[model samples]
Target chain A: MDTNDYIVQVQDLYYRYDKENVLENINLSIKKGSFLAIVGPNGSGKSTLLKLMLGLIKPQQGLIRLFGQDINKFKEQHKIGFVSQKANSFNTGFPATVFEVVASGLTKKLGLFNFLRKTDHVKIKQAIESVGMGKFLDRNIGELSGGQQQRVFIARALVSEPELLILDEPTVGVDVQNVNSFYGMLETLNKEKGITLLLVTHDIGTISEKVTNVACLNKNMHFHGSAEEFEQLKINDVSEIYGHDVHVLTHDHHHHGGGHLHD
Target chain B: MISGLLQYEFLQNAFLTGMIIGVIAPLLGVFIVVRRLSLIADALSHVTLAGIAASLLLEKKFMIFSGLNPLYMGMAFSVGGSLFIEKLRTVYKHYQELAIPIILSGGIGLGVIFISLADGFNTDLFSYLFGSVSAVSRADLWTILIISILVIALVVLLYKELFLLSFDEEYARATGIAAKTLHFIFIIMVALVIAASMRIVGILLVSSLMTLPVAASIRFAKGFKQTIFFSILFGEVSVLGGLFLSYYLDLAPGGTIVMIAVLILVLAIWLKKRAATRSI
Candidate 1:
């Protein structure tokens, strides 16, 4: 595939927070319209890689590109949406409705001097409705459930009509019961909307089946391939990067588990 | 009060200045309070106080400084203090809140020294400290009018950027919204508003005008824009109500304004609690 076909291209990327290298010789290429999940154990440098990809932090060495532009020269930031793990860290008392939160996504695109015009409001409402949050448009964002709040944040990201969406531990505060539906919504965003997705999560098992590609990252890229190939790998092979024995719970741990326990 | 306002030039200046500050202070206050930078306002006001003191001293001792409004000097100091706070926040990244108190005490210390060097408090100083409706000059009113127009325009233009930055700074930065530059401008706006508000609210009570209305609004407002709207509403009520009451009762405008704001905040909290209980 052409370099332009890849939404994100990272080659020989190395990052060091201090004396220790957080990511070493990382080469990642995410195809357009692909859903890629980067998973690893705690302190696995997954977040650092995402940060580098988003241009939040410069890579210590090597090249990182987004939409075929060098990360340093990538100026169309509004084309790449980002949703942080704000679901848990947000101020519950912050006075903002879901509609207002979603509308903030257009801030950068609208520039510093432009006010929200009529089209912008329509876009904001559509984004919120797309996330199944239309009913909660007027509800204070803090009043919603964690999963619902995450949905609002997702709508905020989507409002900009970004081609590439990046989320860091988006399900941290999301409820277990709603986790499936959340992933389902992401799947629709990826498959139907044709938006490329790069998600960072420590809970690999929860996302493994839904993602098109998986990159197992520790200090190095231990695995980067189609999700089927990743699932085919032995449990020991996966656990090796974690530096400890780790269980791969592919979401079914929540379903068909009672039957297994009874058997 | 209407008759007094119409009859006296000083009263007109004071009331007009109060009206302008009532809108801008609480409008910016919504962002400040939400961003948890309320202390920054207090700190900037103190620094403005220092500037006022210095200007008063210069006018007293130096021919060159005479006939100049001290508000201009206070404006300079307030802006300078804001820039310094930004610099200090970066210096002590882990202890960002430390910057506010450090600037606050430094400002008050400089103010006290300047006051002492200027032969301590006199009638003019008293008026500045407690707010005097009769002391606001036509020049001061014009300065405030210009500053209010500038602040209000900028706030309207940058409303979404400010909201995004305040709500989630990391996300704002990730969107590549020139976060540092926006933040720098915001702090300067805070400084300008503090300087503009000091004439009617008094130096010591100016931060209250910036914060208390927003505090009241937060209890009742359902959304971000609503918060700003309600804050400005509460601010206008407090300023106008306090101005009229102070005039009729011969009370200090600054103290009266701040007390009225406090009462509104209490009422808002009570009403919100009552509503919550009724729903329960």
Candidate 2:
């Protein structure tokens, strides 16, 4: 890969909790400005890998680097944004307006005890508009639909003007129609704004069409390549990556074991 | 009713101090409630009882009761207990809730021993138990004021960080917010509020001030900022109203204040349900 191609590099990463290995010997490199989707079965370490990449969790046995340096050394925290799978993971009844939640993206860069400035306000407005939520800026977050709430979170992620936006299963609980629009908007963001996108989802029907790259994962990674390569892979290969083809066939219709049904 | 406040300095002090704690505690409570750490505050207040009991016992044993006040010692013990909880929480990272019962039991056990040793059962320890407005001094007022200012300033400076963490700790940590440090600072602040509140609300009822207003606020507030504001507003109303009623009824101020807060909480929940029904 060329110098400008790669934005994230992980090598031989390992993570465990309470003597249970969550991630096992994972190695992956992601291209800058590329849209990547990570698909996996439940408890497949997809979220854990993203957490490690974002430096939320430490690798027990291997090195992970971002932007050509160790993630631990990266001081510019404001340059990246993340949206967890649970959009409602935050307080569903928290007292903030959509605008305030979105503007919180700039919290790290603002001076201590400083209220938002005019430029900050302008950027927030821009972010709201970017997510087509300008009309609801002052509305309470709890009043929003799941799709709209997810959009607000996306706006929160975008308000920082991040170079990389990592969303973990953002459309999991959204309606099928909303999922289509959400993916469309994300594709626009990746192509129009040149924003590097890393999304984790179990839904392959839509993601396989839109994302440029795909990574299949279980406790260990199985595939990391272009989406075209993923489509060409045999059913046996897909089954090996996901551990079972029935799971993928039934995922859209049935509820997985103890997995939260997101709203 | 207003004349009562002016006629009794002790009453005035109680009302003022109670009002301050009323606002600050519930303000802090919003975060705690959102973060599901409401019970932690309850545990810490109980722990503070041990500190107060120990201070009383120490004062009696050392015979240093002349010019020195025991409240300072109470505050120090409270802070120490707060730090102890923080340390324990860190040590038991996955089982954080377990720290609450351990510290609470330890504090209460020590409190039982100290209170027994000091023979403070029939004495003015009732003021520390159910809460009496008559015990607050000018010094206590000053201490409450300083702590209130510190709480307000810290909330303002770290508003976004706290908001982010309260909303989603994993996301906040993922984005490089020092969530651990913030959590420690928050618990310490809460401990200070509980300590400061002990003189007015008493150890038994202090956690009620922290919880009831938050319960009321969550009924109406839609998001994070409104919850904070509404919680403070609700707390102020409950405390001031309770103070006035306490004076009229000649009851324990802490008990009355917490009772009033509970009433308001019930009223708010009722009104919310009514509104929901109407809308439906």
For residues B1-280, write the lDDT of model 2, one tens digit per residue: 6786788787678878987887799889888887888777777777778877777777677776534565676667677777887788789999988888887788789889999998765556778877777889888888888999999889888998898888777777777788888988887888888888888878888888888898898888766778888889888887888777887888777888888888998999999999999999
Error of 1 at B150 (Å): 0.2
Q: Candidate 1 at residue B110, lDDT?
A: 98
Ten contiguous residues with the weakest lDDT in model 1 chain B: B121-130
Docking class of 2: medium
User: Model 2: clashing residue pairs?
Assistant: A94-B223, A94-B224, A95-B223, A95-B224, A95-B225, A96-B223, A96-B224, A96-B225
**For model 2, how big is the iRMS in angstroms?**
2.0
Q: Among these predicted structures, which one has the highest TM-score? A: 1
Fnat (0 to 1) per candidate: 0.87, 0.74
Measured with C-alpha atoms, the lDDT of residue A26 in candidate 1 is: 97
Q: Against the unseen true structure, what C-alpha lDDT does each candidate score? A: 0.89, 0.82
DockQ of 2: 0.60
